[model samples]
Target: MPEAIHIRPDAARPIDVAVGILMRPDGDVLLGQRPAGKPYAGYWEFPGGKVEPGEDIFVALQREFVEELGIEVLSGEPWCCVEHVYEHAHVRLYFYICRAWRGEPQSLEGQAFAWQGAFGVSPLLPATIPLLEWLDRVRYAQPS
Candidate 1:
């Protein structure tokens, strides 16, 4: 017989993550593949990381971008937030639209990355799927 496992209630609490959607002037956005040895490794998603305790989301965004992609975020604004539960953990993703940044993005973490006008990559992270749909709606919506 297989052994049963237990999960603590606090373990189900959603983790806060700051997600940076680095948008170029031409409407392209940046994405990066998850590095090997991380959760969701090899899956593509927007560049960002966990929000440290008491840390501002924007600060977290800038730090993560620099650490992961070597870009310094210059201008950005909060866009939206979503919560999702994965086998790994429950995450509350705070999405941001970064309009300005300094330096060209370099993959500092040995992961592949690209600027995409249309996200054509396969094996997108599950948490990012709905965010993509929302992006499409915003990008293609008729202006008032």
Candidate 2:
């Protein structure tokens, strides 16, 4: 049987996160597995991190890409925003679509990475699933 998870009543306040959907010209997007020892370890998520106090979302996105994936973001367009409440923490994620970047992405944090198509990738972080669905709807929306 699996161990039951516990949540403390006094969990820390919600975190502001900047997330990047690094998209290739071919319409695929990059996803990385969370490193062991972190919350939601092993689950795949868009490459990003917590937004430090007073940091702009764009700057945070660029910094996170370089810090986490070793790539310098050339351009990132604001895509969407979502908030989710987890047992341990609440997070407000600012999602960006990064279509341009320098250097090949390397997993500097020892986490696994993959380029995934529009659908069928499994076991994504709970927060990322809705973003993917939103992307699909926006990408495939019928002409008015």
TM-score of each: 0.87, 0.85
Tens-digit lDDT track for model 1 on 22-114? 887677889899989998899999999999999999999999998988889997778899998888788999998888899999978999998
Off by over 4 Å in 2: 1-13, 139-144
Q: Please give, for residues 50-117, the per-residue lDDT of candidate 2 as tens digits.
A: 99999998999999999998999998878888889876688989998888899999979999999888
Model 2 Cα RMSD, 1 decimal = 6.9
Clashing pairs in 1: none
Best by TM-score: 1
> How does model 2 score by TM-score?
0.85
How high is the lDDT of residue 123 in model 2?
A: 79
Candidate 2, residue 34: Cα displacement in angstroms equals: 0.5
Model 1 segments more than 4 A misplaced: 1-11, 140-144
